[model samples]
Target: MDMSHIPDLITPAIPVFVITIIAEALWVKRQRAEAGVTLKGHTWKDTLASISMGLGSVAVGVGWKVVAFAGYAGLYHLTPLRMGSGPWAWVLLFFLEDLCYYAFHRVHHESRLFWASHVVHHSSQHYNLSTAVRQTWTPMTGWVFWVPLALLGFSPEMIVTQQAVSLLYQYWIHTEAIHRLPRPVEWLFNTPSHHRAHHASNAVYLDTNYAGILIIWDRLFGTFTPEVERPVYGLTKNLSTYNPVRIAFHEFAAIARDVARPGPLGQRLGYVFRNPAWKPKTAQAPEAPPPVEAAHPSP
Candidate 1:
């Protein structure tokens, strides 16, 4: 397998990121001045944090590519899934990747280890196209989640290509500008409405809609929720500061604190990997009620 093409995978992501930022700035200015909607403008700290996350994503991709190449060289072959050669293959790969992503995403929310990285993405209180760029600095550690695809004999190139396409397909779905699409499309693909529900902090909305390009996985797995009611975006405990360092390391620091508590070995380990909301009995605090509608606007 030629490792040279690995750089190309990341190159396309750059333009998409740039274009999305440009569009977001123009839209945000309009949204704040004309519409009644309040825009959560960026601080330099958040911007730097977002850039750091992007760099982390690139690093993860590079590492994954190395693993993929080794897998191909030793056990598999490099066969690119050609676009336009077969529609069925494309459909199959699309749904398969979505299923994989669904499982990966759900576990990220459920498991503290994964959420430590994913939480950075959700630290933003606002939901806009730019929020999509606020990616994770720790997804590389979760690369094991995609090993099933390689075991199933997907060529390294095909796997990477399909994964890239799936991510690219998701970029446009990060906006509040577009509401519900046509019913048929909404039923099949994930749109802004579905993503908004995923990003929502509402009790009923958390850990829902863990799809990528296709939402069928969420529907099949019973994690799908409709966007009939508007969503309240961000985490349960919103981080008030726009400091990138705080945003990136908050969950990690919390995990460390939890792990430092007096407990049995198993319990101590569980505190770090069980779930983001997990609390040891001694350290447990009162559960706060979900934020009321009066406090925040619905997406």
Candidate 2:
């Protein structure tokens, strides 16, 4: 199988993504109109912001592809282990690539440096199909995660294309239009229900269900959290702007600020390597002298 010609599955899927997003928007609008239903349906500005971010990501990814292929091909040549280019190879790549995605997704959420890129997708407060296209400007971090597959004998082409397939498969799961599937399917796959929980900023939902295609990885890794209530989507401290530049670079600027603060080197590094929610303890001023207590603190 000549895998080099496996055209990007995502670029061609844009029209489908558009049509379905419009349909989901209308459906969600109607659903929200129903009695006792209170969905914060798609906002035009938010959707446009997502589209802008998606376009920026593609613009940057065009150049990144060469780096990715070269990185993978270089590794492939270093090893003698070669899996035959057959259907089985693709099947194996599918499962292995997903596990790689699980690791990539989990780490991006847990670490501030990576989260600075992945956060673009979750920047929207609305959970609609448009959110699926909200890609990152720094997608370079994503491909390197799968380079290990090349050393295991899969072609560089196969490694790249399979990653797109996993991403394309995940697009539809971003919509709130579809609810839960059958129990068995829900148990095995990453459904909208599961992904909704993953997108949620609710305390219980934070850092859970990091699956790309299969939910099994999250289940086995103890990151799975079922969606019980409708999720409150977006960051715990949501952004106030719709500017694409700000959306793409906000967290990075935040990391720069945190790292620049006067502190121990390890504490500064923590701002980059630690959880996005992690904060350094502030120095406390010594308590007022007992003599001052007689006057009581002025309000």
- Write the residue-wise lDDT of candidate 2 on 17-115 in tens digits: 889888888888887777546766689999999888888888887778777777888899998999978999989999999999999999999988999
| Worst 10 contiguous positions by lDDT, candidate 2 | 1-10
RMSD of each: 8.7, 4.9
User: After superposition, which runs of candidate 1 have C-alpha atoms over 4 Å from their true positions?
Assistant: 37-48, 68-88, 285-299
With candidate 1 superimposed using the best TM-score fit, by how many Å does residue 22's alpha carbon deviate from the native?
A: 1.9
Model 2 steric clash pairs:
none
Per-residue lDDT tens digits for candidate 1, residues 230-292, read 687789998887666677778989888877877799888997789778766767777899887
Query: Which parts of model 2 have CA positions greater than 4 angstroms off?
Result: 1-6, 34-36, 283-299
Q: Which lDDT values do the candidates have, in the order given?
A: 0.74, 0.88
Alpha-carbon deviation at 1 in model 1, angstroms: 8.7
